[model samples]
Target: MRHILHNVYSYLTRCVFIFIGDITLNENRMLIGYARVSTDEQTLDVQLDYLLKAGCSLVFREKVSGAERDRPELNKLLKKVRRGDVVIVHRLDRLARSTKHLLEITEYLQHKKAGFRSLSEPWADTTSPAGRMILTVFAGIAEFERAQIRERTAAGREHARARGVHMGRPAKLMPSEAVLACRMVTDDGMPVAEVAARFGIHKATLYRILTRRQAMKSTDKSLNKIEKISQTYKCQLYE
Candidate 1:
């Protein structure tokens, strides 16, 4: 029921903006446009016409997937937009692939004191009061989702550590293979590089494994000393 109401409200807001667009589209703001097609083979003529007909003074078109981040044309359009300018897109998906990306682009436009509108998605018009508030709400939701994901990832890493499961890429050499390589380097006096090469691992890996082992040994000694002190204190208390 709540979702249905939201959709109805959005539709009403969209109609209101469409009505507003007819009246004050070209009052003082320039309508700059951006269009995109997923592949180079796809034609952008239809989208271009829509943008131009919608009163866009300038348009930027690109032949790249919406998921791609290295869109030179989009970057140029963003850099060119100024205060009181409005960016127009044929559709919302043409501008962004996900909600997070959409919010980020809209936030950047807001920072530039510009606005955004979509020919097919009137509810996305940033020039309206409700539209600006909607963008702010979307941005806040995206941020909260990101924070939740980060917390979950941290918790998962901690759970994995508690289970003795390594969290990174598997080691290049097995424990038996590493032990043999270490023996060759230490006892037989073979070069570390040669031992690493024999085990199909890098020299740095050999040094890292040895250094980590030494650190663990040091930690064990410190823990043992602390345990002994704890035991002595308990005995004294009992006495």
Candidate 2:
């Protein structure tokens, strides 16, 4: 019921725009075209011919899949668009990989005060107020879904942490193995490289583990000496 209300509101808003005559469809606006093919085996002749006949002043062409995010020609056309310019494509699929992607592109064009149009899918055209209203509602819904996903992911991570689950990669060496490696290097006076190779670990890693163990031992000894001094001072005070 709420979805129906949103659609009705969007339709009403589009009507208001049309009634106000705030946006004109074909008044000194440049039509920029973009043509794309998934592979070299697929010829772009049909798309190019259609774009040229659509009165596009300039057309950017490339042979790249819509799924690929780094399309050079599409990037160029997007950068070329200015305020009041309409970007024309041979088909909807030629412009974006999915509905989310289409909404994102149209949102960007709208931000630039430009417009988007599809030769095959007339309803997808953003040059008209109705098309803009429809796409805006879709973009809003997509954003809401994405926010829900992010919230769920963060809650899941927090739950895992509360249950004492490790989040990242497991440690390479066990506690006993690390203790033995450090002893071999320090007590037995063995070469660090030889000890590391025998344990099938990197020399640098072995050094880090040994250094940490040594620092821990040093701290323990210091704490023991401090306790002894405190005990002796108490004896003197009691005497």
Candidate 3:
């Protein structure tokens, strides 16, 4: 019982010391800033200045294409941010090119208990309810735009097919090459792997060429038989 009591006393003393240390430590709220430029011609200085003025303790800048997902500076900024921190950007577009990507990033920050703010888009501050609503609307629009593009592309393909116009890339291998490849494999007793390697083609491509050649040969044979029968009938009628 005395040993147990001693352990409890020590635990309480450690807790008291930890509490005192925490009280002595100065807590400063982190204000992290992220800036991006879509092209080399653009500059991040303006965004950096605005972010600094907006109360950012640290600023991260990236001169890269917006379409690129992996950015070194952006990763570093994300790693540095902690719970109860604020990540500020010059604008919503500066943070992400697409609405979906923007929402994803912001959602991660929300999960981390970090706040998001945009200097240009005042309504993009996640601290307010209105900002969340605006973001939802933007996400819906972005998804709608993507769906419309897909629909138009599909409709265009259907129209082309109805007009008997072939869609997609033209055949890469010529008829002669296909025929030669088939002959080499079937008649010459050459291995498909060797033939493909010799021609600097993939095994799948070689197989497709061989199949096309066989189909063409069968079609040509049928036409030749019909021609011969017609010739014989014409000769019989002349005699």
Question: For each candidate, what TM-score against the reference?
Answer: 0.55, 0.58, 0.46
Which RMSD values do the candidates have, in order? 20.9, 22.6, 26.2
lDDT of 3 by residue, 1-239 (tens): 35434544553453233222221112566888998887865577888899889988888988888666567786666556676788899988877756656755664455455678898889897656667556545544544454555467668989999999887643354333443444445544556665554344555666656555445676654334423333443333323
State the lDDT at 180 in candidate 3: 40
- Candidate 3 versus the native: TM-score? 0.46
Ranking by lDDT: 2, 1, 3
Index of the highest-TM-score prediction? 2
What lDDT score goes with residue 13 in model 3? 51
lDDT of each residue in 91-207, candidate 1, tens digit only: 999988678567656655654567888899877878887776666566545545554555677689899999998888435754434444444444345566655543445566766
Judge candidate 2 against the unseen true structure and give its global Cα lDDT, from 0 to 1: 0.65
- Give every collision pair in model 1: none
Task: Candidate 3: give its CA RMSD in angstroms.
Answer: 26.2
Could you tell me the lDDT of residue 131 within candidate 2?
75
For model 2, the run of ten residues with the poorest summed lDDT: 222-231
